[model samples]
Target: MHSLPDVSLRYGSLQVFHSLEEYKESGVCKIPGAVTLGKFDGVHIGHQKLIRKIMDFAHANSISSIVFAIEIQDRPILSHEERAVYLESLGVDILVECPFSREFMSMRAETFAREVLSETMHASYVCVGTDFGFGCRREGTASMLADLGRQYGFQVEIAAKERLFQEDVSSSRVRKALAKGDMKLANALLGRPYPVMGIVQHGRHLGTGIGVPTVNVHPGANKILPPDGVYASCTRLPDQTIRTGITNLGIRPTVGGKTRKAETTLFDFQADLYGQTIQTDLLDYLRPEHKFSSLDELKSQIGRDRESALAILPDECDRFYGGPAFEFHGQG
Candidate 1:
């Protein structure tokens, strides 16, 4: 087994494991669980429904609720750290971030169920989507999983697809909405504002020069972002305080900068935030990023953006201010 030193981290009541080996090594596997497995890309409404099922089953049966998050090769809608935070907020007891190793991927579906799910994890029950697949080459189906569950002395629940506007709610759908800069539709599908989480990094101080001092964050390469634009945003600070802001997410073309970053100027706030991990929720798209004629022109547009952001952010703040307390574990 591949043993990693930083195998797990804790967030309040939630325990996160990097792999099945870590979970077994940590002895958390001794506690039987109601488990669900998925990529859980965005943890949107569809994913939430499946999670709720496992949580409820675990609670009723006096077992732990486990989410086996398969780490795939595709770029994620939410990064691993962000997904961990979201799962913690959702009250998951154990989140196993199972790496998609070639060896593990080649395991037979029956072997996976018998060894990993039954023998190792000690799952009392399992939940998954109706279209779930497993095993090498995606050969396992929901019915196959059910049969394996019976053989393995576990119960299986396959949740129906969650739909919105007569279409299935999925990570791909959310990505498409973001790609088009449709914050409204994306938020509607996600059942929350789209979030960008990162550490505050020092920038060129251009915003300060223009009298708008901003906090800059580089979204990682794998994180999918909305089309480069100005957005009405709500930022949650290190102290768990939420502040309204105007976020410009793009390569600063007028400044001749090439890196894509989110530079947010928080309204009515003036505390240094360098190196702090913060979550900025994009509420509404204001406008596409534009290169202005001069610094003065850029500053004027930012002034207008702040006003527009303020107008749009109050209601958003009211909605999400006290909803969930997100803690950054320095995983990013």
Candidate 2:
């Protein structure tokens, strides 16, 4: 398993407020802005549409654009780091990550409006999905929010939910797609390849003994991984270099692997990446995970997986790896 160092993280130029008090300490509550509230698990295309609408409205009104994101009760679809990076790239001026503790979850509908919507953030307009809810036992509805806005002197705007391929797009839908090894559909829903960010950890040097080398990454508990399989993927190095690679997300049965991990072997690169943070973007699925009878057979199969991956992926590594293509696709 990988270990993450305890440290404060930043998202490009955008400031992240981890708590309401922290936001108040930053003196941002004084700034009038249009706000959106949600858990924002994946920040997928559906989320993009909602955020863009709020941003456009705020811009037209010459006010700030803020996203009041809440912590998810379940395991998060994307790591906090990945979400922050994507939100900043989407042109959000501020990200208020409200803690979803027991006390906050028990707050009443009216109190949420007064404490968070009116006094704390000082929002002029509030935007949300048609199904959005808040406060104690989800007693707050979009309609209730609009009425509350009227009482608090703010406007409420509700954006229609997004539908993709006759089915509504959602973080849970993306996860279901990944669970079935459908990276293509998942990519379309997310507007980018699936990315998992983590520090490179030490592993049994089975690859090297078999004449190939790889870096092993252990995703955090909250980060959801695609179904176990061999994938055509790309890696972003700490130096910002994009490297073409083949990744495997599964337990190496032949090598006696016990835990599921993301293992990647880059083409034409030989360097030590242990302890360095890296992002591996899975572009396409090549094959299902299998149990090999021997190391020789496993090595031969890997050679085939690499060739198949190269045939399916772009020849120029930077074309889709770390360049502009990854901007809104959640590679950062």
Candidate 3:
């Protein structure tokens, strides 16, 4: 057996254990927690309900809150790092990125529940979606988990799947919306704008020549993205400043570019951002990417894109700066 190191890393206020074995070795397992497990690909509204249940239970019982995020896909709506940030923002106490290795894939459901959930993690309460499946070949269902919870001395809470537009909110649905470049529908399902994070890289500086300097960032292979198009975007700079911009996500065929990257031009902001990580959220789809005959044509179109982006972004900035307030009603 290949043993993983006893590693526990901290992200903001959340503690992350690479695997169940690492959690046991870190000695943090001594603290009983309300636990929830899922792939949580997009951390969509459906997943948020499960997380909220565990958070409420943990807070009421004065126990730690833990999330077991199973890694099962190569291209996820959000990268593992982005998921960790979202989980931390939701106030989860710990995150375990459990690798779905062959050993784990073949493990019996009952054994997983007993060894990992009951004994090792000391889960007092467990939450999952109604359609959740686990164990080898997905032989374990929500009902099976509930039965196991009874045997293992833990309570199980099954949250119903969230629906929007009479359709179930799922990671796959989010991906489809993005693939269609339906940013509005995608963001509505996500309960937030679709975000892309990457380190700004050096480019051909074509935008500079057109008098519209831009920053370039590659979204990476593991992160799924919308179609290649120009989008009205809101970017969070390294300094934590939010700037509205127009972002083009593609190979820049107009400039004879071959690399796929997100090239963004902030409306009224300019600073050297190379080597720094920035996050851009796609707010709305402006237009599909097109090859222009000349730099002047591209520049003129970019000016029009700026105007269109300005029209849609001011309201977004208002809401973003104001933030949202949540009122939690006690579970009856």
Candidate 4:
């Protein structure tokens, strides 16, 4: 196993390869390097720890840090585009996105270790979760990788498991939290706010008539919505400006609404956002969606929700959002 040193952690540049052939064509990852492999669905705290360790080792050893990951098509936490941006924020130099197909899934553990990690990635060191397993039918384990590292000439390190709320933090557990509308738990495990990106779409102008304007969004498919509720949100508009607001993720049960969507009441915000993409960082879970006896009653509740949104965000939201989400780590 190769030894490594300590270095200050900071994110630098990023390059992504959609295929192994494209990666080799770029003439990168052809020499010994530090690599971390995972699906990294949510890019949660546990995943961050592994990536940071690998990046640190790479920086210390004077080699490139590559993220060799599988892009799971079904029910993924973050899309490939979003995941690449997040990994770049963590200082990964190269991102090797492998298409998760039937043939790739059927590849044996030994073949993956020898062909992909050893030959293609030229991995000098590899870091993965304690429960890490891969290859045909989940036949590989952390110990199996460690043993193969000796044969293939690379070092293996199992990331220490992280815990919150007295349970192991994991992508599955995070999804469960979102299902239960526990934003604190979900966001805590994610190491950042739950990210939901969508394009602003037209909806019934019910709020406008009530004197409260809202932006309706059509979320990208497979985005897990949090239990149909009202939440405090940090929104990024298409012009690259950040705004704080309150959002409702529901079928609009109140006033006989239909279809699942998110409506945002951007505080002191006035703009033409129709047909533009907006990314919302849900910060705090407020209240669950409910049907009111009348539109006036619903309007009153929204007025109160608006006041609460103002108090939840930082005093200067514009400056706060200018930094990476990782800066807001720990229980607050």
Best by lDDT: 1
Candidate 1 structure quality by residue, lDDT tens digits, 1-332: 10111213445578888988899899889999999998888899999999999999998988999999898888888877777777877789999989999988898899889999999999999999988999888888888999999999999999999999999998899999999999888988887788888889999998899888999999978988999999998777766666778899999898998999999988778888997788888999999999999999999999888888777766665564533353221111
Worst 10 residues of 3 by lDDT: 1-10
Q: Which ranges in model 2 have alpha carbons more than 4 Å from their true place?
A: 1-9, 60-62, 315-332
Which 10 residues in a row give candidate 1 its minimum summed lDDT?
A: 1-10
Every candidate's lDDT: 0.85, 0.82, 0.84, 0.78
- In the order shown, the candidates' Cα RMSDs to the true structure are 5.7, 4.7, 7.1, 6.7
Worst 10 residues of 2 by lDDT: 1-10
lDDT of 1 at 202: 95
TM-score of 2: 0.87
User: How would you encode candidate 2's per-residue C-alpha lDDT over 206-305 as one tens digit per residue?
Assistant: 7988888999998777687888889988777766566778899988777888998999988778899999888888888999889999889988998899
TM-score of 4: 0.82
Task: Report the C-alpha displacement of residue 278, candidate 4, in angstroms.
Answer: 2.6
Give the clash total for candidate 1: 0
Clashes of each: 0, 0, 0, 0
True-vs-predicted CA distance for residue 226, candidate 2, Å: 2.0
lDDT of 3 by residue, 292-328 (tens): 9999999999999988888877666554333443211
